[model samples]
Target chain A: NAGVTQTPKFRILKIGQSMTLQCAQDMNHNYMYWYRQDPGMGLKLIYYSVGAGITDKGEVPNGYNVSRSTTEDFPLRLELAAPSQTSVYFCASSYSGARGSSGNTIYFGEGSWLTVV
Target chain B: AQRVTQPEKLLSVFKGAPVELKCNYSYSGSPELFWYVQYSRQRLQLLLRHISRESIKGFTADLNKGETSFHLKKPFAQEEDSAMYYCALSGRGGDDKIIFGKGTRLHILP
Candidate 1:
């Protein structure tokens, strides 16, 4: 399977511009997440969803928004993009929470590198 | 707040030498710890979990509750083992939200 798929492997947005990072999973995962990876730093959670229509904030959710409208899709929206948002964004999914019922397996899509100028 | 700490940013070891990556976590309750690795240009993937007490790719990690540490070790390092490693922590039960360390870039010298 394609597993988790992310779009626009690379993008450069002008300051104040808006864009969306699309993510999808064919495994019918109930949990989805968005994370940003900065150079020399760990991946920071931006937003995550437990299931459809359920979204929660993560450590760094200031400039990002996410919606899990369907089990297969969780798209991250960037409004009024800023330079600080420049980083490699990763989208991941799991059947359940990492240590929860389903299992501790998380499948990740190829990261999307965003640069804000 | 849950936190995962990896003190080293880069670690270089000669081929066939022993290697260890240190990780410490701060959590009040029983936690689920994990090791994630990313090879050059490859997607990040799980290496092992503390709960399973299993070994992967000749690497193993033992979770020490008293010390709040889970260090990944390999008796003999290989060039293929060179990659970025991250230690992670998650809340008990199914709270998929995990906290990750800054990550350590491992370099296996030939």
Candidate 2:
């Protein structure tokens, strides 16, 4: 089974442009997250969803919007891309319903590289 | 505020040498720590967790509550071990968010 899948492995956007980064997981996980990694910086959470129809803002959610319409999908939208938005984005998922041990391990996708000019 | 710290930005060692990646964390309550690794052209994946205390790929991490540290160690490093390693921490109970460190790039030369 494909654990997690992300589309548009690479993309280039002009300033003020908008685009969506799609994320899908086949594991039926309850928790999904979007994170962006800049040079020499750790991953910063952009947005997250506990389950379908529920989404929340994360540490670096500015200029980004997220929606969780289905169990398998949670997409992140960049309203107006800026040079600062250029970075690598990753999507992750974890099963929260399970007991303590299994719930904390997060699985990440290959990542999407976005370049804003 | 909860945070994770990895002081070393880069670490290099010769193949077959011992390796250690240090991680320190700050949190009010009990925390769950984890080590994640990313190899070239590969997705970031969980290497180990403090809760599990299990070793994978000859790599192991120990959580020292007294020191507020969770350091990853391997007796013998291999060329394949070269990658970026991150230390992460999540609080107990209802806290689902995970805080990650800047990460350390480990390079094992032959």
> Per-residue alpha-carbon lDDT of model 2 for B53-80, expressed as tens digits?
7999999999999999999999999999
For model 1, the local distance difference test gives: 0.89
Residue lDDT tens for model 1, B2-65? 8899999999999999999999999989888889999887789999988888899999999999
lDDT score, candidate 2? 0.90
Instruction: Give each candidate's interface RMSD in Å.
Output: 2.6, 2.0
Task: Kindly report the root-mean-square deviation of model 1 from the true structure over all alpha carbons.
Answer: 2.1
Candidates' C-alpha lDDT:
0.89, 0.90
Q: What DockQ does predicted model 1 obtain?
A: 0.58
lDDT of 1 by residue, A33-110 (tens): 898988766678899998999999988999888988899999999999999999999999876543433355777899
Query: Which residue pairs collide, candidate 2?
Result: none
At residue A89, what lDDT does model 1 achieve?
A: 95
